[model samples]
Target: MNSLTRWVRGPWTNPTASGLLIALAAIFSFTEGVNPFSDGHAEGAGALPAALIASDLLMVAAAVVAGTPILIKAVRALMTKMIAIDLLVSVAAIGAVVIGQYWEAAAVTFLFAIGHALEARTMKKTRSALAELVAVAPDVAVVMRDGKQVEIPAAGVEPDETVLVKNGAKVPVDGVVIGGTGALDESSITGESIPVEKGEGDEVFAGTISGGGFLQVRATGTGADTTLARIIHRVEEAQDAKAATQTFMEKFSAWYTPGIIVLALVAGLVTGDAVLALTLLVIGCPGALVVSIPVAIVAGIGRGAKDGILIKGGEYLETSARISAVALDKTGTLTEGKPYLTDVTVLDPALDRSDVLGWAARAEAGSEHPLARPIIDAAEAEGLPVHGLPERTEPVVGMGVIATLDGQRVSVGNLPLLTVEGIADDSGAATEVDRLAGLGRTPMVVTLDSRVIGVVAVADRIRSDAQEMIARLHDAGVQKVVMLTGDTQRVADAVAAQVGLDEVRAQLLPEDKLTMVAQLKADGYTVAMVGDGVNDAPALATADIGVAMGAAGTGVAIETADIALMQDDLLKLPQAVDLARRTVNVMRQNIAIALITVVLLLAGVFAGGVTMAIGMLVHEASVLLVIVNAMRLMRRNEDQHSAGPAPASDARELQTAGAGPLS
Candidate 1:
């Protein structure tokens, strides 16, 4: 009894079942040779056969079944003082029935009922991409407490708790690996297909799957504070937000529906043709125009989330489509931020490479300078003996270090420091320094008291994908890609040459980057600045769009950057720009479809061939077409993760077709 009541109150009330019943009634009415019901007009009711009476009753019963929901919705909308499409549909269906057009009323309501159900089902699929992210969130956790492993809800794990993750288990929190080793499939967080190896001190994120090995993670964030939670939240908010085009369409639809009603009333009063007026009302529902932009935005944003690109909202997606110039912060954006020792040259006749390295390491011992560790690590890597630090050391800002060793003076820095200390480099030290700088290295000339001994150099590693990213940016329609760095001109130029960058501005301060961005805007270019989000904050804020890479862990990065890539992958940059352009293209196409559909529909209604039933059929078909068109965005671009760039010919075709980026 309970199950029957539930069924009666559920699917039976949905109107889809009513559509099925109406379909059966139509089959019996349309072909009088088959089934018990027969078609007949109401003009000769007294002389009607049993078949004719039964057929009319069957059509009327199906009409009531399908029209009840429309009538109820119309009443609710009227109570709120709103003129909804449901009200228009209800009035049209009732007028058809009053005129003894049972076949027309039944067909109109059945088509609407089935269309609504199909629309609801397809729309749910558009949101499923983001829903998959929320579904991957860890539900269970195993934490080590008081020497015992305790199982609990993932949210119950407190901050700083040491959680144990084994092979094939989902990581339950955002944390640092404290012990053990593992390879994790981090695709859920980063969208990278490969498994990343994690050891002690490596960072891990929630919702990542452990592929092999075990790990002890010290949790820093759990539950709602995890990166997975933040991504899901951002995507949900973005899908709900409206674009400017969507807002305008909604405003137009609000007035369009009412105008249709007024037009229908006027036509009926002028021509004294009730049927013609009812057909106009049915066709002028604004069904397609109302949904065009919103569906596109939802599908587009949700697709981006699945690929680990987080757009802030519809507004940002629209703005990104106009990007013509992009500036990158050199240290972390195009190169690995960590400096590594690349070269060491010995110029002194008395000492070899080991002697020079040992002296540099001893002087740099106990130093906190950024370049010190690379030199020290390189010295240790060569199995050199590095003892105690110099008794006293002084680091000159932007020059080098000055230190005092036993009974002597030792210095390691640039040639500027040599000149500042009144030490002359007569053994072609200047030539050697220039040679190292030419190779993109920051050379430090080490001097033992007054003698120039050797020069040791360190440089940040260029990312393997740097050149590919540059090429892809051009393929995506970016006019310029500039690299901004605080390094010397030689080092910056070397990197720019290797990466094929269009422009390189070297030796720039943080404020200087902001000035460059503003200059791009002044030149009529829409700019995007990719940076680490700290020193580049001003420049990022000044540009039309700011993109942050490796943003999975930082809340500010995910929230503030216009486009946040969950992983530190350069390929994602071009993919993001291409996606924004494609989404904007889809939005424009949908609007065109909606407008053209309405115009053609209006023309058909006045041409006298379109009846009430036919108008409703076309109206539902147009709404479905708009929705299905938006769903195309939900499909993954297979070439998005491929190594190659989009074809130049493809871009040219898009431009010619008028279906490319907005600008």
Candidate 2:
């Protein structure tokens, strides 16, 4: 069952079917044209009519072969009462054909085919963001076996196996470089344009292109476990999970068709004219109403792609407009997620920053924590030498560490760890700690012989565009903005204020976030939850619309979310929302136009002011006009990213008021 499902869902699902339909259309249209066009009366009225008929017929056959199975399935499900509205339109078109209106039937079929083709093309273009990632994945990898290079499949390379990556190839998996130095284009993973340089021990993710020189990296993951595969899967699922909006035409199509048929019958009985009834049947098709929403959706999706945003589908684009509040994650969603060293304090005046970091790095050399890597990395970058730890060392869970360095007892950890160990019970250390924490920094205390020493502050930087993006959301009619984070309350509050958010829910566990989302939903708010990856999965799943930062977001988060922003740009959130709202507006506009056109045509037909040929011409022209208007959505994307200006400063108001520092 799984195998069959995979096969049907694969790329081959509609290609063969579309090819056959196109072939049939070409054959039929050619047959219709052979007799008249060959007679050499090119300027004759018959010639133009015959040529148009031939062109339309050929297009119909092409579209059917390309999309017939899917359309057939849609129609069958509707007829079987699975989807009643679509079934009505399908039946009406068939009725037109059965009553000797072959031209009308052919026109309807051809238009439907073209719309479906446009939809398919949009999906393909949107998915190319992920497909490009897959295309760059390494096929054959160089693995180190017994200190010699051996060719092996990327899938076969196991964890900790050193693989050589040369110039112009993608990194096979997430891993650290062990040899050589080079620049790497990690834009596929981080959405940053600049290619970053990497040396030994620097981490790289799969799908990043290698630059300028060879490097040997130890593979940390592979296959579905690779970062690229996870990202691709997340994109695919997010696009698929977003349910489409039911257009005005689609919702009323079933009953509307029958109502029109009845109206036509009543008119014929009252006026004794059969031609008027047929004219009513031709004018009442609702082709414009049907085409409105999907066109806007396609345009929105296409626009997103151009601006480095890849919206999965039409549903997500529509849902974004309805969002009243947004839930944001901390680590990767707002901050850089990459920790950097900011300041290092020394307990002893004699011991400078360099001396303290060197001692701390040596003690944490064997630690596997993410925090530890940056400390050791900082020490190395500063050219400070590290020595092996002394006689005793111990780790205090959720706190700092205690060890002997240079025959003296040295302690490193959070403030709680220091207090518990009976160290640095002083006012100066307390003041410094509070100062660092207030800036949304992570402070690490270093003590010597139970005496107050200095502190090291590390922090993840906020994205440069975050402040402006939040402002745009408000301008676009978002009622409220909320931030959810697992960080300390102080840090959470600071980030919230900086981003112009209305509320901040700090120190939330994964389950706590889910509970909060439920509370918001119960209050009837249309909430959009945006997150990076794994930690945000629960909340993402619970929100009205789950929007994942696809490239950096985890597989679970993306799969759970309703929308995936491929570029991982926070600014794209506002752009998507505006795009959706505009698309909906366009759909409404098209519907109004189509309905007015139908009503006017029906009145003229019943009054005998319009003949059958004139009615058909006017009706067809209206459909074409509705279509052209909807296509405007495809072009309106240029305005989605019109960010006014960079924010002056989030801290400007506070600075001017001389406000006391926040705790």
- Models 1 onward score TM values of 0.91, 0.70
What is the Cα-based TM-score of model 2?
A: 0.70
Kindly list the per-residue Cα lDDT of model 2 for residues 566-660, writing each as its tens digit.
56577778877887788778767877887898788778876667744355456556656666665565564555456543644534111100011
Best model per lDDT: 1
The sequence of per-residue lDDT tens digits that candidate 1 reaches over residues 1-663 is: 698786676533546566566666656555655332222456643665555556666667777888788889889988987777777778888887887777677777777776666566665677886778888899999999999999999999999999999999999999999999999998878877789999999999999999999999999999899998988888888888888888887778767878999999999999999888888888887777777787888888888888889998888898898899999988877776777777779999999999888888878885667778878988899998777778998877767778888867888887777777888654678898777676777777889988899988777767767778989889999999998877767677778877789998977889999999999999999999999899999999999999999998888898899899998988899889988999999889878887787778879988878877777788788878888888998998877765753233211111010000001
Worst 10 residues of 1 by lDDT: 654-663
Pairs that clash in candidate 2 = 17-65, 18-65, 18-66, 21-65, 22-62, 346-454, 347-453, 347-454, 400-413, 533-554
Off by over 4 Å in 2: 1-244, 305-313, 359-370, 423-427, 550-558, 640-663
Clashes of 1: 0
What lDDT does candidate 2 reach at residue 207?
76
